[model samples]
Target: MSSPAIAVENLNFSWQPDKKILSHCNLAVPQGEFWMLLGTNGSGKSTLLRILAGLLTADSGTVELIQPVGFVFQNPDHQLVMPTVGADVAFGLVSERLPTPIIQQRVAEALGAVGLSNLARRPIYALSGGQKQRVAIAGAIARHCEVLLLDEPTALLDGDTQLDLVKQVQHLVKSRGMTALWVTHRLDELDFCDGAFLLENGRVVDQGDPQILKHRLQTTTV
Candidate 1:
């Protein structure tokens, strides 16, 4: 049997001892699938993404990630830490104790893939928000993760940058066969993916094609 890219079953979690946030969640993501996780605010989208990324522990459920996973957080500041764009992109690999030459090659390749080669030596803090987010993406890509989790990636981006990011995400899914789980409140972002899930109150209320889901979301909002 082919291993699922990610699987969650009867998952439950809570920040506080008495207050439960997620309740009896079950999901299965297959290899190379592009999935969009949609929800309203406070719907546990970010929390679920964190759980899949191995950052948060579930209270009492099975959460399995079959391969190395990369995460681009909602906040670019949280991901970009090094002095220069190149350095920041290389930070994760360096921590893994990769050889210096390999690290250098990976860093250059990652930056070039993100169209940030010229900005390799540029200070990370000086770049525009969109550029900083791209650097974060490059850093994640450098990890060569089989699964990529993005939490509200476009919330802080302008329209042009948001569209660009979606295109890049599509490219990654096609070329790398990387499974992506994107959590976002914006319905506009769902059009790029093949399937989407609507999450509300910590539960998956609907799941289907992007166009159908988009229409449902609009109707509910109206």
Candidate 2:
């Protein structure tokens, strides 16, 4: 069998050393599979995604990422640092010192792929929240990552922007054939995924197809 895109075994983490956020977590994500991480606020969903993205290391147990991961943070402000849209998207490739021509080609292709080709020369701050997120995603694609991770990716956007971002995510998974791990609290967004894991109190309390949990939650709430 092909190697999984990501694997975690008996993982545990704590920001304050003694206050654990993730406890004995075990997970494996196969290549090209999309997963939605559903959880209430402060349930460690973001923490787990951070660990998988190589931004944070678990304090105990094993966490392994088999594929290059591109992370789109919840807030685009943190990711958009360069002055221009093109510059921000080019940051990932430029750091590797690729030939200038190659970097330019990739930047153009990535921007064009996300429908932001027209905004390439525009200043980063001039773009709206959704546009910034798209640029961040374009940057990740330019890096040639096989897996993408997101944390509450649409929490700050308006309704239309949120829908556009969802379509963008679908394009990333279907067209690019990349594995995606989406973390979100919006149950409606869960339909955008095939499977989901429900988290509570920093633990995975339930998991399966998103539709199943939808029914379960509705039934219990009723």
Task: Give the clashing pairs for model 2.
Answer: none
Whole-model Cα lDDT of every candidate shown, in order: 0.85, 0.85
Model 2, span 1-222: residue lDDT tens:
887777778888898967889988877777777788887778899999998888888888887775668999999999888999999988988668899899999999989889999999999888999998999999988888888899988999998898889878877788888888889887778777767888777777888778999788778769
Per-residue lDDT tens digits for candidate 1, residues 1-222, read 688798888889898988767878777677888889988788888999999988888889898886788899888998788999989998888768988999988889888777889999999879987888789888878888888899888888899999898878878788778898888888888889978888777777788788999998899789
Query: How far is each candidate from the true structure, as Cα RMSD in Å?
Result: 1.5, 1.4
Best by lDDT: 2
Candidates in order, TM-scores: namely 0.94, 0.94
Give the distance in Å from residue 220's predicted Cα in candidate 2 to where it truly belongs.
2.6
